[model samples]
Target: MKNRNIDFSMVLALTVHDMKNSLGMLLNSLDELRMENENTFDDSSKFNTLQYEAERIHNDLVQLLGIYRLGENNLSAHVEEHFVPDFLSEHLARHTPLLKGLDIECSIVAEDINGFFDADLLTGVLNNTINNAIRYTKTRIRLTANEQDGYLVIGVEDDGEGYPEHMQHSGTLSFKSLDFNTGSTSLGLLFVSAVADLHCEGERTGHIKLHNGGPLGGGVFELWLP
Candidate 1:
C-alpha cells in the first residue's frame, strides 16, 4: 500500500476562501435586510451583534487568505497613485450602515494629497483595523491620512481604552512572533505588516506603528507606506 501526504495548508486556504465568499454574501444580504427593515434592525442590539460578528469573521478569513498567499510567496502590492481624502471617504462609506446602527460617530480627516500604494491591499488592512476600532470604540472612531516625513501615514483611532503597554510597538511585525497561548494572536497585525512590507520605495519599505493617544485620545493604528 502507498501512503499519501496531505497539504494541510492548501486545504485550509481553500476552506478559508470559500468561507470568505459565503460571509461576503451573508453581509450583502444583511445590508439589504437592514435597508428594507431599518426600524427593526436599527435599534436591535441582537441584530447589531449578529452583523458585527459576521463582519469580524469575514475580515478574519480575509486576513487568513492573505497570510496563506504570503506564505506561498504569491502576495505582492501593485502600487498606484490615489487621492488620500477620497479613498478614506469611500472606505468609510462601507461601514456607514453598521456605524449608524451602533450609534458610533465615525469620521475621516485626510489631506488632499495623492498616495502611492496598492488600494486593494490597503483596503484589506483598513477593513480589519476599522472593524477592530468599531468593536473597541466607546462612541467614536476617526480615520486620518497624510504625508509624513517620507511616507504616507494612514491612521485608525478609536475612543476605547488604549492598547496595553506590551502590545504597543513601532516596527514591522512577524507572524512567527504571535503567541497562540494568549487569547489574541494579533493575526490581523501580522497580515497588515505583510501588506505594508509589500509597498517599497527606494531604500525604504512600509511599516506599522501602535501607540496610545491620537485625536480621539485612545489607541491608534498607523500604517506608513513609503
Candidate 2:
C-alpha cells in the first residue's frame, strides 16, 4: 500500500472558495429579505446584526483568498486610471443599506482627481476597511481621497476609539507579526498592506499608515499609492 500526502493549503483554499460562494448567496438572500421588509428591517437591530455579521464573514473569506494568492505569488495589482470621486462613491453605495440600518452616517470626500491603481484590489481593501470602521464607528465614517506629495492618499476615518498605540504605525505590515489569539488579528491590515505594496511607480511602491486624529477624531487608515 502506498501513502499519499495531501496539500493542506490547497484544501484550505478550496474550502474558503466554497465558503465565499455560499456566503455570496446568503448575502443575496439577505438583501432580498431586506427589500421585502424594507420599512421593518431598517429599524430592526436584529436584522442589522445579521446583515453586519454576514458582510463581515464575506469580507473575511475574501481576505483569506487574497492572502492565499499572495502567498502563491499569484496576486498582482492591475493598475488603471480611475476617477477618484466616482470610484469612492460607488464603493460606499454598496454598504448604504447596512450603514443606514446601524444609523451610521457614512460619506465620501474625495476630490475631483484621477488615480492609477487596480480598482478591484482597492475595492477589496476598502471593503475590509469600511467594515472595520462600521464595527467601531460611533455614528459617523468618512472616506476621503486626494493626492499628496505625488501619491494618491485614500483614507478611512471613523469616530470610534482610535486604533491602539501598538497598531499605530507606518509602512507595510507583516503578516508574521499578527497575533490571532489577541482577538484583534489585524489580518485586514496585512491584506491591505499586501495590496498597497503591489502598486508601484518608479522607485516608489505603495504602503499603509495608521494613526489617530482625523476629521472624525478617531482611527484614520490611509493607503498611499505611488
Candidate 3:
C-alpha cells in the first residue's frame, strides 16, 4: 500500500539545465575579458586557446545531453525546411570571433536549396564540425549543403592537412571501432554519428562520413540525412 515515485528523466533534465546555465555564464565572462583586453594577449595567447577549449566543452555538453535523451527515447526531431544559406550564415556567426582571431576565411556554398532536418540537433553536429575546421584550417574553411542521391548532404571543409588514413572512413562509424588517439574528435564524431542515425525515412537512414580533399583540399566532415 506504499508508492515510491522517482522521475529520473526530470532529474537528469534539471541537472543538465543547471550545468548549461553555469557554462553560459562562464562563457560570457570570458567573452567580456576578451573584449576589454583584446590587445592584452599576444598572437600566441593562451586565453584565446582557452576560449576555444571552453567552446568545445560547451559543444560536448550539448551533444552529450542530446544523445542521452535520444537514447532514452525521450527526444524527437522537429524536422523542417530551412534555407541552406541562412543556416550556414547563422552557424558561421557563432564562431566569427575565433575565425577572425585565427585569420581564417569561412564561406558557405549552397544552391538555393532547402534542407529538411532538425535544426537544433543538426547545429550540435555543425558546431563540432566547424570548430574542428577552425582549429586545423590553414587559412580557409567552407560549409556546403546540397541534395544528393535522395538524401540531404551537408559538409564542412577545411584547408589544412586532412584526417589520418585510419580515421578516414566511408560511412558512419561503429562505437567499437572509433580511434581514441585521434585527438579530441573521437567523442565529437561519436556524438555526431548518434545524431545522424536518429534521422531516418523509409528505407534510408542518416549517416556521417569523413574524407580527404574537396573544395578545400583538406578534411571534410559530411552528414547525410533522409
Candidate 4:
C-alpha cells in the first residue's frame, strides 16, 4: 500500500513568503529605475505599470506578514490617539500617483476624528480596503469618519461595482473568509479583523464590517472602534 501525505497549508505559507520577498526586490529595482531614469519613458504607461506592480507587491507583503503573525498568535498591536486629517493625508499622499494614473478621485470627509488605535495596524487595514476600492471603483473613492453608539466609525467607500452577494455573505461570517484565490480578501481583511479585535480598552473591542450601500453606493468598509 502506498500513502501520500501533504501539509498543503505549510506549503502555501512558504510559497507566499518567498513571493513576498521577490516582490519587494522587484519594487526596489523599479524604484531605482524610476529615479535614475526620470525621462526614460515617453508615455505614462510604463510609470503606471510600475506603480501598479509596486502596489501589488505592497499588498502581497502586507498579507503575507499578517498571516505569518496570526499563526504565531503574536500579532502585537499598539493603539494610540491619532488625528484624522494627518492619517488621511499621509495615506492619500502615498497613493497619489496610483490615483492619478487610474483617474480616480480621492477625498476625505470629516471635520474631526481622533481615535486611539494601532497606527500600523489601522494603516494596513485601511490601505488594503482603499486599494481594493481603487481597483474596482468607477471614478471616485472616499475615506470618511464618524462617531456612533460610543464607537468611532471609519469607512472607505467607492463608486464601483458593489460587492456581489456571496462576498457580502463571506464578510458577514468573517473577513478572513474573503476567498484568497480572488486576491481581494487575502491577508488584508484578516489582518483588519485581528486589528479590530485587538482594539480593546477595558471591555470595548473594535470590529470591521463590509456593506453594499453608502454615499458611494458600491462598497463601504467600516472599522468600528469601541
Off by over 4 Å in 2: none
Q: Is candidate 2 or candidate 3 better by lDDT?
A: 2
Best by TM-score: 1
Flag the better candidate by lDDT, 3 or 4.
3
Model 1 C-alpha RMSD vs. true structure (Å) is: 1.0
Predictions in order: lDDT: 0.93, 0.93, 0.81, 0.75
Displacement of the residue 7 alpha carbon in candidate 3, Å = 9.7
Residue 35, candidate 4: C-alpha displacement in angstroms: 8.2
| 187 Cα displacement, candidate 3 (Å) | 2.0
Local error of candidate 3 at residue 189 (angstroms): 1.1
Looking at model 2, the pairs that clash are none
**Ten-residue stretch with the least lDDT total in model 4:** 169-178
**Candidate 4 residue-wise lDDT at 115:** 79
lDDT of 3 by residue, 137-187 (tens): 899999998889988899999989999887787667666776566564487
- Model 1 worst lDDT window (10 residues): 1-10
Q: What is the lDDT of residue 119 in candidate 2?
A: 95
State candidate 1's TM-score: 0.97
TM-score of 3: 0.85
Off by over 4 Å in 1: none
